[model samples]
Target: MSTPLAAALEKALQGRVRRSVPVTDLHDDIIPCPAADLFSNDYLSLCTDTRLRQAFIDNISKEPLVFGTGGSRLLNGNASAHLEFEDRMKTFFGAPAALLFNSGYDANVAFWHSIPQTGDAVILDELIHASTRDGLMASRARTALYPFSHNSAASLRDTILHVLRAHPAIAAGKATAFIALEGLYSMDGDFAPLPEVVRLVEELLPAGCGHIVVDEAHSTAIYGAQGRGLVAALGLEDRIDTVLHTFGKARALTGAVLLCSPTVRKYIINYGRPFIYSTSISHSMMCALSTSFDYIESSAGEELISSLHHISRTFESKLIAALQYTPSHLLALPARSTPADFPSNVVSPIFPILTSYPIPLARFLRNLGYRTRPLPYPVVPRGQERVRIVMHARNTEEELDELIAHLLAWSLELQEEEKKEKEKEVLLATEEVATSKSEPAKDKALFTISLPGTALRIAVSVRSFV
Candidate 1:
């Protein structure tokens, strides 16, 4: 069983084993058990929306459904359903043109791989999604990729300036400069300052040379008028060069669409390998996407968005209050200061409960019937490990209260444990001091009480006693 690949994989996965949790035994009726699903990306709870489900079924049943696309879009898979959906998306999202991809990951890969020709530069947020990085890595266009501080406008400006200085082509407007960003960061659960970022990009790069690309994977079906996304919400849709709206999250469907100009779409169609080679999505999937968008624009969808906002505000306020007295190093939220001029309507469902012991905290919550995922190093930066909690529109006040209570309980338990451990260390130090009292003067050594970094690594010196 130990082939060359197997051997290499075994060595590489020594300490980082990953496993999937099957959902066969974790359902409530036809949908996932909501009581424990705090990690799913279904922010709008559209997966369980009976109306959406029925609409999808009815739409697919309207005519003969194509279960699978025969070939790639460039081949026989270019069905009318795909074209109609793209047109609908362009109108709905207010984009000049729209192109569909299998998923957000696929769209990013295709776009990043095909766009940004030689001599161009792509400035990315340090914490941008891995798919973007993969696309850039696979890109044969010789485009230089630069990363700036996460969500920092100052850093972005600096990075763009540095790139311009380093590459005279970009400065002279002979090359394009693309800025990649996410509307909602999944790990830290923070919104990118889209307005500030767009403004900086326009000011730094040469006129008509700079392009802003935003991936609204975690923000779609949850923001703006009818969930048009942060770009549309901030009135910067005209300024942004390209936008990626994923259907997997709040829309509770599959696939993604890249909103760009007609020229860009045509270029991707010709050069994007993934789009040209991969089989297009089925007609049924297109029907489902159409249905989902229909529901999102409905009054019920508006009500859900309002409910989600209220829940987000309530949860954030309550959690902050609950953690007011807890030690920060043990468990706390990431210290993100909101700008005074930032929009108040930009709320996200993702919440990160920062902790040094993310796995233990996540396990504790899971044992209490709250399923949250722990993100460790590489997923998040070192020292930024956390348990990521995603809120849903279906989440009730009672469920939220119980979750908060359990979090508080965990925090209190940790505090009590640390207190007892400190006492034990003090007693042990005293015992060591007494024991050293019987030793000869020269033999008596300085005693130090050890503590973890969470306790500030207190160095209790018994030198005086000795």
Candidate 2:
């Protein structure tokens, strides 16, 4: 009981908590079907694609399974499959070379720990993935988390200028600075204005002073040209220093790859602790990944990506129209402060709709048959709790309509709560007035009604959701 680890775990558990919800109460076979799925990351519907399943079976049937590589890639674990996967990724990403990692977390850890030299500095977005931040914390170099406002090029310039001012050694050519950012923010479903950031790096900072770094774990896999990602779409591969892409999202697979120069790859291969310590991916998984890439090149891949975007766009337009009705409290991003109108320029399939009572509302949706999850405190900041919805190619228009219907019902629920709360406040205020009326000896504490009681009934709405 007095163990240090136990004490730490106890401290960490002193709050509202979560538990794993099994698909079935007992086994995977007894899965319960939910109404609408809104939390999946399979943007392309590739996970259930018949072609991919066939490819997996074909590859596994033809090739002998290599079980698990018990050693790291730097050791005897290195295999032809591993090398081939890396090569294919490098070519696909248009990079000088590419390196593999067990997952995005490992890739980020290796990158942050090894790349920024001792004298170098790292300026990263405050909202960068926790994995990336963990890696930064493990690094030997100095690192600072800049504000999320750096998503704007102008703000990025200001933040860099401010950082360089404080750490003059970096600006004075004494130490190098690296700017780290996300290509497409996974949580907010927004972009980083990378072109502007890239321009700032190219013109404002010298080659030796700093370089642009991006984590494309969300965007590049299924968003842009031929599912290559934002970096490729913007032709930023030659400009940005290090870009991390993973198969977990759109590819519906495990593992990640880092696209950089062969020299940098060599450095990471030699010095990156995460890459050197962890066991390599399974041989069958590697073969499946290889086959998946092959599928990504086919006409089917192009159609799915296109279809996903179209469905997502259509869903967005419908949701916008629904949430904009009079007295609506549903909040969307880019208008965090309760905008007069929600933006219609949603380019991503992910959206975080704010809710004051997220868990109850989420549970209500779940019981009503939607697989919607509430993103609270640790997932997002407090008071910014949300119902996060992710669209996939397989999400039908009817399912989207049903989800929106539930959302509208929830919006009505919020309205009802607000109305009840308002009426209670009014009653309390009237009681206070009656108490003052009772207190008056003469005219000493005479209570006055500002307007007719009927007028008060028709009074203006109070500041609520805002």
Candidate 3:
């Protein structure tokens, strides 16, 4: 017997959008349509670089290992190549040791679950990546969310103090407290105040009571003189207890590394479930990552970093100019009248256009041949739906101009529709209120009377005329 489709399936399929390029039935000589690329995470465009590709190929050819890891790293999967990559990363990021994971998600989960003891308390930023929060939930430690006031070090310190006071046992060294935060927040593209955080930890945290862990997933290959990430850029390698770096973004590869002290590395290696139970990353993958590390050490990597900086600056200027020309009417309805709806002062490259509803914004962009992602509820709380436009060094000036044009036109149209809807709602509400006010008052004398039975009953009546 075959499974039947649900009734909801038909509705879901009604307006489903397809990818820009068709994946199937491609001809050898066909030239694809020219669509501006705006929906990729390849910020530095390293994935498509001819030189990087050749380096990857060359490394694979020179390496002895190929194909899959037969078992986990603790078992039969650990290879010499894997060890080489780990050593290279450890030196590159200025950490005592480094351990590799298949992906950022796995690495984060593994670190969170393994590092904190049963009696530890994990304090994380409110807006941390979902993976980090998920990892914390899976860990044995008790968790608390601190308010992240858009790079306000004062807020972080205050929150930590509050938590410490609330949980005196943790402060007294009876329990551990771990502070977890990302060096660069994924959604906002803003960075945490690492220096201030370090100072706070040194000044406030009692010995054996707390530690700080920094997630460098978005910062890797995007900061530092050698692109070693923000931690290395700020000379905070020894200051942070652990640093998480990934190759999926700026590194343009698959896999991530956790940088920590030798003792911590040994502990996680022995206890981390993702590393213990799952098959290790393949040797071929290790070779690719090793090649990437080699490229970073070479002169070509310096040139790439310089190019990325120039590109990022150009993109920022173009975006700001475009925003200035956008009509004032295009602005979305002011945030709802609530404390949480208060405007934020944080500024970064990730541009979020708040909307009354995200579906309209998504549909409008789709119709204009631009792909904008919708960040709705669950990801963001209700009433904060927005269209997130991520910029990259790979995007060209012409593409940026085209995107701006489409956004301006779409905004104007949306504003018109919103204005009309508001007017209609106001008129309907006014009419209803007026109709209720005009209704005649009831006469009490007609329904009221005196009755005699076992006892006398009296009713006081008032006269009314309408």
The global Cα lDDT (0 to 1) of model 2 is 0.73
TM per candidate comes to: 0.90, 0.84, 0.78
Off by over 4 Å in 2: 1-8, 17-33, 143-150, 172-174, 326-328, 331-333, 336-346, 377-379, 432-466
How do the residues 104-145 of candidate 2 rate in per-residue lDDT, one tens digit apiece? 899998888888877676777778888877887878774454
Candidate 3 per-residue C-alpha lDDT over 1-466 given as tens digits, one digit per residue, 9 for 90 to 100: 3335755564444423321111223342132213555555555667777898998988799867689989999999998878987888777777899999999888888888787887666777777777777677778773454545655677778877887897788778687678888877656556787877888877887875768888888778766766787777777787788889888987888989999889888988998888788899988888788777777667887777666556556655676666665544343322211112211211233455665456655666766656555665545666666676655556677777887677777777766765675565556545544555665434443222222111123332222212
User: Each candidate: what lDDT?
Assistant: 0.83, 0.73, 0.68
In model 3, the runs with Cα more than 4 Å from the true position are 1-34, 143-150, 173-175, 325-349, 419-466
Give the number of the best model, judged by TM-score: 1
Encode model 1's per-residue lDDT on 1-466: one tens digit a residue: 6799998877656535442111223352333553556678999989888988888888888858648879999999899989998999999888899999999999999999989888888999999999999999987644588899998988988999999998899899898989999988988888788889878888888899998999999988888998887788888889999999999999998999999999999999999988898999988888889889999999989989988888888888888888888888767887875544556877777788888767667768867666566776556677887888788887887878888888888878877877987787768767877776876545343444434323234445565344
Error of 3 at 36 (Å): 3.0
Worst 10 residues of 1 by lDDT: 19-28
RMSD of each: 4.1, 6.9, 11.8
TM-score order of candidates, best first? Answer: 1, 2, 3
Over 4 Å off in model 1, which ranges? 1-4, 17-31, 141-143, 337-342, 437-466
